[model samples]
Target: MLSGMKVGKNFWNGAEWYLTSWRSADDPSPGPYRRALDTSGLPDNIVWEGDAKTYRAGPWNGRWFSGIPEVLTYTNVMEYEMVISPRETTYSYITKPGGPLTYIVLLDTGVVRRLVWDADARAWQTYFQGPRDVCDTYRKCGAFGLCDAGAASTSFCGCLRGFSPASPAAWDSRDTSGGCRRNVKLDCGGDGATTDGFLLLRAVKLPDAHNVSVDRSTTLEECRARCLANCSCLAYAAADIRDGDVRSGCAMWTDEIVDVRYVDHGQDLYLRLAKSELPPPSSPQAFPTAPVVGGSVAVVVVIVLVLVLIVIRRRRGSTISGKLQPCLSLLSFFFFFSSFQFLRLLITAAYANIHSTLDVPGARSCALSFPCIEHQLSPAHSVTSSSAPAPIVPYVDLLTLREATGYFSESNIIGRGGFGVVYEGRIPDGRKVAVKRIIQSPLLDEGGEAFMREVEVMSKLKHGNLVQLLSYCKDGNERILVYEYMKNKSLDLYIFGEDPKLRDLLNWERRLEIIRGVAKGVAYLHGLNEEVIHRDLKPSNILLDDNWKPKIADFGTAKLFVVDQTNPTLVQTAGYTAPEYITERYLTLKCDVYSFGVMLLEIVSGRKNRNTPTLLSDAWESWNQHRITELLDSAVAQPEPELLFELDRCVQIGLLCVQQSPNDRPTICAVVTMLNNSSSQIRAPKRLVFDAMTEPRLREADHSAKEGASSTSNGSHTIYLS
Candidate 1:
């Protein structure tokens, strides 16, 4: 350990490393706040007020802690680790050798700072800090409350669903320390007959671990059953969310849950609640209850009045139709006249507006027509004029791109696909980038546009497991996308390479980390404002940074599903495509899930999911024969017990992901949650839909052409073994 480090603490020095308190400038004494490594379970950095954890740097998730996703970008500058053994467990980090001069300090106040020495300025510069905002404050919202930094309100604290502020007076006065209380109490009688369920809270930091029981052997479903059986368990979450599955077991709270808040890249927490407290399911019925009730009463009154009128008319021997005919005609005439005038007035206003615009002398060149042509002609300008795009990702001039990629030299080529060729490049600022130059063809305009749209989406997306889109160039027929270069390139070359040394690099832990990263990236894509489904999610599309951390890439073939639209096209890669997607042209988030599952199994076995005699069938057979160890990659020798358990659990999840029925498949979000929570239960998948990969027609075509299905005389579709 460096200076100022204790048996339970670690430190480093480089730049101006110092911590200041939120006190009078003259006060140099320490405050209540202290930063320390939490030794419980997987180690993480936490700032505590006495014994209570006030703020956390988040637990390590392979590459970095859950909350600090930016660490992925610093792979070239830093390395972090947590050591666990029978003797002791500790968390530590170090700057990459000869990379940067940096130091970290825990302030007397509450801030944790990482600083670097600025040689030119002869001063220390702040590199990073935790508790950077009010939302970072621990338990800013009391128990069962959520803190949203982006919420549109005067206060960030809000109660979780099925819950309300514990003290209305305190809440109103902005004193949320009382926290929140459930609206309905749990109905558990210890007989498993009670009406109780769980409420899932997404993107949240797990609550304090106090008074919580942790078990690493049960699945998530089993954990829920356990919590339900106890009757005192208030909440449950996965004990180890590293693999994103319930098989890792779980943690169940038996007392008041505290210090819970939402973070950008946080874990999921399933809070136990009474069934009655659950929010009502949503429906499409738009008619109001008040209108229905009032209409019914009016109809009844009208019926009674008509009956009396008819009786009087019959007694008088008079025709009621004749009497009402004149009145009805008068009302109809008045209504028609009003409607005619309204239509005429609307038409006149529109004509006047059009005429006025046309009268302008300069407007002849401009199309000032309805469904304005100007907006369509200058979309880039219009989009920017209305609302500025994020500056983080921008458009680059063609000249700059050409200089970066040596005018698309063959020597620079790094990756190739049907849509484009990716080349390694270095920008003017000495930062490395990958430039993808699209193949231009008049018949492939849609593909080009898709590439551009993907660039737009990728620019806005920020995640550790996603390839960052830095800029783009769309000059004339040349369309190009700039990305942050990954030194390790794609995963396929490493895992399926001829070199045994290369294959061995992906040990059990590394493979699990890759799976987790890919799951996270997929989950983020699925949860976007407009859900994006990467129809092609094969290993070649998964890239790795210098540290071998995986990043999901190649969105050129992605399908963006708007709120009301659906994907009707059949598209994917061979062996990795979902059966439902190919046969019925069925599309959903589950299609990508299936591909991810296939890739996951491949990663574990170090083999490709090829045609006919498939990896899928082989693994399934091995699983059924109770010899899954036979399917393990030979590179991983003499696996430890823990590694074997993780491998088995991952294999189970992969099978679950590749289920034949899309409905039976879990969503990508669920996959991420499952990967993190070891105790989450995974249901055994049904038998897979078998395909004949060696068919004559499939053999005639290339792998890329084998994605479609053929229609039979009976109107049913058959997979092309793609």
Candidate 2:
């Protein structure tokens, strides 16, 4: 909505806020790189390389953009506004009064950034930037193609419903730019005779709108009618997606749709397709066929005949009981036959359910419902495994990844761990990311598959406090995972490495924030439909972004399980492992709760739990002695008396998470509630005792190495069985 642009959404539904990069700092001429606020169906931030889109911030939800949850977390300092009226629709950013001066700029290199002035440092700190990871890249999978960060397939893209790639050879080569061609073309005749039906694509960024038309006066139903009336209209959607019942206004696309992607909190988009294009009905043979009908009639007739015979026997009244016996046998046989048919139907339904859960091509493996839609809908989730495909977690090309990392040059190396090495790299679009190349060996084939599956699981995960698995790479003999780069790196460097510069950066308030952030992340994971257990929850696995916001990373060893299900996988680090995990070879969400408690203690004491086994014990004793301040990290500035109470409460909660029995430990949900509500009271924990067997496992911890570590381990590690 800049003054000179003369652009307004009222006149042009496709009007957008464009940002052009200059050739140089002093040059005013536009460069090849540009960014735009796509205000078509829904507003999404997009960056472009010339005319080709390179990145997209998935659509604006009620609170924040669907793709960027971090901004929602830091909303206190900044506010985003989107105003739609009869004359204009505009999107703008506002900084809180007396807050840091911030600028949103599109760099010449095709990277879009949000920067804030830091007066203390006298530098502009990058608050946020994109394309953050491979998933953010626009048209990454091509037109009518779906890109899923959660896909397990080597390639990230897949054709949309009723479509196939236009060029299979190009797709096989991992080049999907040719997009897709319809398997069944629309049956909307020019005379208004149409047999085309709309397919619901849930949780998706609406396709490009250059060829779309808008009519704000119409309701969604009216919009549908209009599209149905016009044979040329390919699709239609509500122009404004708000949170109430009166979601009216219309936007229709008529030409080729491109750059469609699936994301959490995305808008529902309806794609027009012929009936033939739709998947065969779930109950293909629900209606009675001629044979079935005939058989059913025959069974009914036989039952009637048997009843008639029984009546005649009763009328005859000669040994009625004996005559009835024969009729009863016939009735029993008929009932059995009916029961058998019913059981067969039940078995068929079960098979269909399982098939829908896995092989079914849908927007999500599970059911999804939108507020705007009356019923749930499912489209192609992602291309995955042949047997049991989970949702797609897109894979990066090895050559592309190699170019990003400068062919694994030493200078690009940023981290080393049990998983592999992490390198800092920029994709072709100039977006910085972290690339993790899993160490390959003859012994790691199974491990690589496990890692890939775990990445798929993690890619489905989205939270402000959790590190995002944007995309991954699985070339022959190489496995690489691309993630949103954390500028501050792992938490261990600040807490355990005795780096005064790093340690001093975290004050009492910041430390508490980090602790709460991690707790929230763990709670989110635990709250998922299938609860996740972070088997290796330690300081090294916790990362900090530029804003000092903590994000939980490394899910390679994590376990996904349903509530009340029992898993006997003893996957954990030595010091943080719950006692039950080692002794009984049992695992549960409580195991993660215990690890979080240990991490909480470490963050507070600024020491490794292994080195200080008595940290929890000391905390418990100090809480009772009313001298908990003594347990706080001495290196950090002492908390004021008022803050000491909150610190004591946190320590008590930590103790609750690390109690002896699994049942004694608090659920992650309860921990989050406790952290959020300082006034809330917690139950007293049992007397603290460091597990006796924990110390002996320290050698194992050293051997496995930990995630987010900058060092490698010496020996092969044990794989936990789920």
TM-score, predicted candidate 1 vs. hidden true structure? 0.45
Query: Over the stretch 195-247, how does candidate 2's per-residue lDDT look in tens digits?
Result: 87776665566676653687656788898888888888877777664434465
- Local distance difference test scores for all models: 0.64, 0.67
lDDT of 1 by residue, 1-722 (tens): 23223324322321212233444334667667666656564345678777777777665433455555445555676666555444444555666667657677666556566666656545454445566444566777788776654332245578876789999999999788789998888897746677777766645567766436866667888888888888888888776654534335677888787666555445667777777765333210111234334445555555565556566667766557688556556555644555555555555544543343232112211222221122212212121232667554677999998889898899999999655799999999999999988776543354455556656666666667778788888787777778889988999987788898888887777787788778877776776656667778988889999888898887643443222135455445677777765654567789889999989889988888774346776776666433679998887775654356456657767877887678878887667654543323344454455433432234345333544433321011111111
Strongest candidate by TM-score: 1
Clash pairs detected, candidate 2: 149-393, 150-392, 150-393, 151-392, 151-393, 362-379, 362-380, 362-381, 363-379
- Candidate 1 segments exceeding 4 Å error: 1-392, 446-452, 556-570, 691-722
- TM for every model, in the order presented, reads 0.45, 0.43
